[model samples]
Target: MTPYTPPTQDQLLAISVNAGIEELTQSEKFAHAESDLVEAIVEGVGQFAAGEFAPLNRIGDLEGAKLENGVVRLPDGFKEAYDAYVEQGWNAIASPEEFGGQGLPFTLSCNVLENLGAANMAFNLLPMLSVGAIEALEHHGSKDQQTKYLPDLVSGKWSGTMNLTEPAAGSDVGALRSTAVPIEEGEHAGKYKIAGQKIYITWGEHELAENIIHLVLARLPDAPKGSRGISLFLVPKYHVNDDGSLGNRNDLRCVSLEHKLGINASPTCVMSYGDNDECIGELVGQENRGLLAMFTMMNNARINVGNQGAHIAERATQQALYYAMDRVQSARAGAPDKTPVAIIEHPDVRRMILRMKALTEGVRALLYYCAGQVDRGTIGDGDAKNRAEILVPLVKAWGTDTGVEVTGIGIQIHGGMGFVEETGAAQHWRDSRIAPIYEGTNGIQAADLVTRKLGIEGGEAMIALFDEIARDAAEQPTLLALAKDCAHIVRWMRDEASLDDRLAGSVPFCTMAAVAVAGWQLLKQDKAVSAGAAPALAESKPVSVRFFLDHIVPEAHGLKASAIAGADLLYTLPSDKLVAG
Candidate 1:
């Protein structure tokens, strides 16, 4: 399992700029990321990924993590690789500088995580969850809590987990039944004891680090029912002293690990809290406001899940392309009869490869653009913040769903080799299946797009996005042709007579909106390239953008029609009518 050596600077410069490293380097927005810092981080991740991480991916899956005597042990090499990650300062990419973080731009964090995911997704779960925990603490933890926990978490000296789902509550947190009772008279009077079970917790219990901090959501006594009653707590595997050193072990224990379809190397645990009546957790933020506090982390985790999709898709696409180039088959129409040609020479194969490339690059562009917006919101003043906030969900929903589709195509390109586990194409396909399911399902994402994101500011945000696309199309003739297609769709969507049509096509309409928005960003890159920014990059921006607009964007019409058609066809049939009974 040799790690793919990343393209050199000059070689990278020659690749397509729709979402290449060269363009990322040249973008004006990334100017804040110091050149030395970027180079060091990228090189470190590249080497670690190729040398240590990638080799262990399959091995980890085969061996898997194990639970013994209430202690969860990670697969071999995981501890060493994790230590290397911490030593390289990879975990601090997006944390605050004052709290032991490097305070780098979110875009850089996205880039680093992409490589880590590509190299080994299962092992990367530890840091991913740690960062999510760090974000939750940064946004809601008290100054004392931040001072005590931020350093260790950011430094990767400890790991973290978000315990949300339960046996009864999966997508709906409102149904959660975990409870927290305050201690009366003790050394930890302000702390509460958490008691309940949480399911589907990733990195829930592992011996990868010194400690594990669980961000548990539970109900307090005398509180209201449902979501309003829930509160967040910082429950640790090993209690921490006032000075932040590890203390006595807590009562939290991993009851069992889930048998998952993919990401088998990353242990998903069933954890029980206060099983021994000694689990003390400090409350985060106000009681009954835990849901609000958890949203910050959920949103962050959702975006990362989307990136998981994007990163895996990129890896799969690369694998497919490599196989297509090397696996020779029957000669094509123009070739000599007895000779064999690479699969890449066939028209259908080329179409599939091109489709994979276009979709992967398109999603990459969307995610990177969204990453830039996040950076701006964090560092740029005023309006930049507003813009970045608007783009978050779109990036999350579109990026991840596209990842699933692209990875599936990656398998298609590999043919029968993909179905066999040995080729690893099936692994990508299996691993990527969870992206859309977790971090909020794709259907939920679509609902949010329609109900919350699209209607923000009374639909002004969406209108503005449409206007920006129109303006871009107007300025560039090549884009104008594609924009014209988008404009037609938009016009139809807005027409009073087309309301039913639009509603019927809501899903497709949303899909079109995604492509239109993605194309808008791609066009900006085209403008940048035309202006001599990253001049050495290949000029596939127009071709790729056009391909999406021409072939993919039209799905909007059908989707919009279906969305507007109402749920009649779906819901009208009674249960009895639907079945033989």
Candidate 2:
């Protein structure tokens, strides 16, 4: 049996209640994606993901992506699955209509990727990055660039890679030493010769797509130092003729692949550009503005990365629940009929399952809310965009952390069998461990939340959201208290905190804010039960929300002391001394 089962009902309810799907469809931009159409899309993608991607999950992890003859090869069946993914138009659902997309709501696309990630996290990376590329180009690329690239990229006939990290530059985009020199003369006079070594290039090399697009960041000769000097370039694996036909191979190739903790089925390549001094690339935008353009892509990726939390957590929770219900173990603690019983009846096991359910559901609701904000923001709701920007770090950081926790809980429910790979239980945990570390680590997210986002519109928007949540959670005073506390801390952070203090307390404050925000969404779902907002899930939704408010949201209160703790204590123990202990 496959480890994943798409939570179709839960997803739809989250979209309905959390994403405000009805309100979203009222916007003229997304008017075509009516309730019936949205339902059909979600169901179709769910079935497709289950049939095409789920069975391949274990196979992909077992066989993994391979590098042979300097070419990266994905697991068998990947090409066929990818073909189905493209042929079905799943890749272009939310892309712009001008570029061959259906022009649906962002939430619809989010649902599609969520299903794919749940089915096979590794397999979805290919299309996820491609969508990110489409976003970047749609915003910043020149008309020629968009015309030449958007259709294929949106169609999933071509793939994309963001080449940012090098050995010397992981998160510090400015520290990169890659160079791009102007050609000055030729058929491609405006283009430049790029030379660089990029590591951690996801899907950098693969045969599934007709072409691979590399968005490379490099420094122009004699440009200003640091990040201001860097520029973004569109470097393709194969040159495209003016007629849009594939031409000769470019001077880039995958030199090596990394052996990673998980997602082994998705190739992480060490890409070398201009090895033969012939790699040519067109500038993506104005010179030295690469970081700004790339941020467009990064911001989108961050949200999806956060949603991966919900994706993996849902699959893991389902697997754990199934195993607990069927795996016969010790007798119930108090029941008189005390022969061996299913572990589902055990208190401890019950606790784990409930916690997993609560965390996943809360995180899912929050991300879905964020998705709705995107649609609202796109349709001229500037306030909604501001709200989304503030919540993104929370989703990216806290959501991913929840993925790791819930997946680990899933493994715990499986017990000894969980530790063994044969049960496919541990793989969820293993695959989930990377979420918090990538797409701008959870630590970076915290720092951004406290230092940058806390100051948005002088923190008024954030405080207002807190005020709303607090009002809604009046009966659940625990959540109300946490919401009020988070709003107060936002004021302190914006007005009085030192940079060091903000950095030191960032993580805890991040956790505190995320929990409060999540409580806000969970409570919304809970209130919707009898209101007919999410009728399909009325029974289970209330239970999950109650569990979250009572058990999980309390963590916010516990983190307050740490959240406000100043920087002094963190520096008291020197780095070496701290490590020595």
TM-scores for every predicted model = 0.90, 0.99
Pairs clashing within candidate 2: none
lDDT of 1 by residue, 57-160 (tens): 88876777787887778777888988888888888887888899877666667767777887787777778888889999999999999999999999999988
Evaluated against the true structure, the overall lDDT of model 2 is 0.90
What are the lDDT scores of the predictions, listed in order? Answer: 0.74, 0.90
Off by over 4 Å in 2: 1-3
What is the Cα-based lDDT of residue 145 in candidate 2?
Answer: 97
Clash number for model 2?
0
How would you encode candidate 2's per-residue C-alpha lDDT over 1-581 as one tens digit per residue? 34566788888888988899999878799889888998899899999999999989998888999999988888779999999999999999999999999999989999999999999998998898998899999999999999999999999999998989999999988999999999989788989999999999999999999999999999999989999999999999999999999999999999998898888899999999999999999999999999999999998999999989999998999899999999998788887888999999999999899999999999999999999998899999999999999889999999999999999998888888898899887888888988898779999999998767877888898899899889988999889999999988888877888999888889988888889989888888777776876567777888888888889888777888887788999889878898754
lDDT accuracy of residue 507 in candidate 1: 55
